[model samples]
Target: MSDAAILCRFEAARSIVRDAADLAMAMRPPPGGPSGKQKSAQDWLTEADGAVEALISERIGALFPEDGFQGEEEGRTRTGRLRWVVDPIDGTSNYARGRSRWCVSLGLMDGDQPVAGIIQAPALHETYTAVRGHGAFLNGRPIKASPVTDTRSAMVEMGWSNKVPDGIYAAKMAAILELGAMPRSGGSGALALADVACGRLDGYLEMVINLWDVAAALVLLEETGARFSPFLRDGGLDRGITLLATAPGIATDLAVALAVPLD
Candidate 1:
């Protein structure tokens, strides 16, 4: 597709994702958390997930009938060279508990390349958008990764997944502490990576994460000059896999410490 076409879709997605996030906020659970079901040990599922996905799918399908659509709640509903991958409510656990950390994420892919993306956190009133070759923005202003080179001064977040064994996850967390950096787990892979892009955090890693989780943030990271693992090359296009995205300054050392390669 031409650059114009890509940018058109990107802009449309921004509006679409923002509306979807508002829909999620309306269905958000109360402060003690909703009575959500578990997809697994700690994985959460809420009505908002499917509701938001359906809204986005319907809107996108109506706007771009030929474009493919994929969602976390509903798998691929349509197929095309230009595909849109979405995580309707990225931090279900947080959203389910009435927290403000969850978001609605949508990414555009041209074949295997992530060309553009939009991540909207309605509860926080923040929106991040990026297009390959263009810059990344947070609520309309440009943003970039942090310049902290020393691991001792960095703050990194590691996302958790049930696919990883407890012992292995602990070992990786210990390794980050060994490097003298603070470690955190925000329960939202997309936002953590966006934090890396906008310099709120120095880096983000995950033992196992799905494409929809990072699809939108990947474009943001790339536009902001952050270093990350070769997720697609490592089979992220087809299944969940390990991911490590960091500011360029801490990328090398962090990768070595975590034993996860960077792109």
Candidate 2:
């Protein structure tokens, strides 16, 4: 597709993401309270999750019937060349628990790499978007990753995968701490990457995260001048992959600390 077509898709995605975020915010439960069941030992699934995903899929499909879609709740619908990756609520556990750190993530891919994306955290009143080389934005203003060079002063968010072994999570955390940087986990990979995009967090690390979870944020991070390890493009979609998105200064050090294999 031409650049103009991709930009149009990018604009369309921004509106779709906004609508999805609004739906999620409306369905969000009261603070400090939750009404949802466990999808797994720790993973959560709420009525809002499916409701939001369905709305996004329906709306986007209506606008671009020829485009494919993949959502966290409904899985994949392959119809054509372009694929819309949607995470109705990136932080389900936090959303179910009434925390304000989750977001609605939407991304478009042409073949392998992302062509456009958006991550909107309505609860936090923050919206991030990017079109391949068009730069990234937060709340309509341009954003950039942190320029900090020292690991000692870096603040990185370390995400844990429920599917991974307990030992791996522990080891990764320990590795980050040993590097003399503070490590934290906000329970949402999309939001974490958004934070990295806007320089709120210096870096983000995750052992195994889904494509829907980070697809939008991935583009945002890239456009914001943040560095990241190989994700689904290298055939890690169904199998998942270790992820590292960070300021340029910490990329190599972080990979080394986590023993993340470089591609």
Candidate 3:
């Protein structure tokens, strides 16, 4: 598609995602948190997820009838050359608990390539946007990955999912620690990856993460000069797989330590 076409979708996505964030914030639970249910161990599902996704799906569908949509709540709808993949409420656990870490994520894809994306974290008052070859941004300012090259000084977030075995999780955690880098887990994969993009964190790795969780962040990482795994090349288009995104300085070493491939 032409730059104009992608930019059109990118602009529309920013507005749609912002409105979705507003809707989510209004429905956010109080300090005590909401009575959310679990889809699985540590995997939360809340009313806002569906509501926000419905709004995004409807708006995107209306604005671009020919584009496809794949959302966390409703799954895939119409098919088109450019697909909109959304995680209406990424970090639902945090959102459920009224924490300031959740976000509404939307990504534009051309086949397997993430062409553009918008990730809005209303609670944190931060928004990240990126289009392929156009660079990434935090709020309205341009952003880039950290220049830290030392493992000992780098901080990496290791995302946890119930889908992976306990042993596997432990092994990866140990690997990160062995690298002498500080390791952490922040519950939200998208935000963690976003953190890597804007230099808040050096790297993010997850044994199993879905397309919606990382789709939007892919372009952010790319435009910010962060190195990441070849997720789609490794079958991420059809199913969940390990994901490792890191700064260029630390990417090679981090990938080896975690046994994850770099793109």
Q: Rank the candidates by TM-score, best first.
A: 1, 3, 2
Q: Quantify all predictions' global Cα lDDT against the true fold.
A: 0.92, 0.84, 0.92
Candidate 2 per-residue lDDT over residues 1-263, each given as its tens digit: 77898898888777877887888888898877666988787688999989988988888888889898998878897556788888888888899988998988898888767888888889889888888889999888999999978889999888877788998888888888998999888989988998998888988888888899887888888888888877865655665677888888777887788877444
lDDT of 3 by residue, 1-263 (tens): 88999999899888889899999999998877454888888888999999999999999999999999999888898799999999999999888888888999999999878999899999999999999999999988999999999999999999888899999999999999999999998888999999999999999999999999999999999999999999989998889999999999999899999989897
- Tell me the alpha-carbon RMSD of every candidate: 0.8, 1.3, 0.9
Residue-level lDDT of model 1, residues 140-245, one tens digit each, is: 9999999999999999999888899999999999999999999999889999999999999998989889999988999999999999999999899999999999
> Which 10-residue window of candidate 1 scores lowest in summed lDDT?
33-42
- Backbone clashes for every candidate come to 0, 0, 0
Q: What is the lDDT of residue 101 in candidate 2?
A: 89
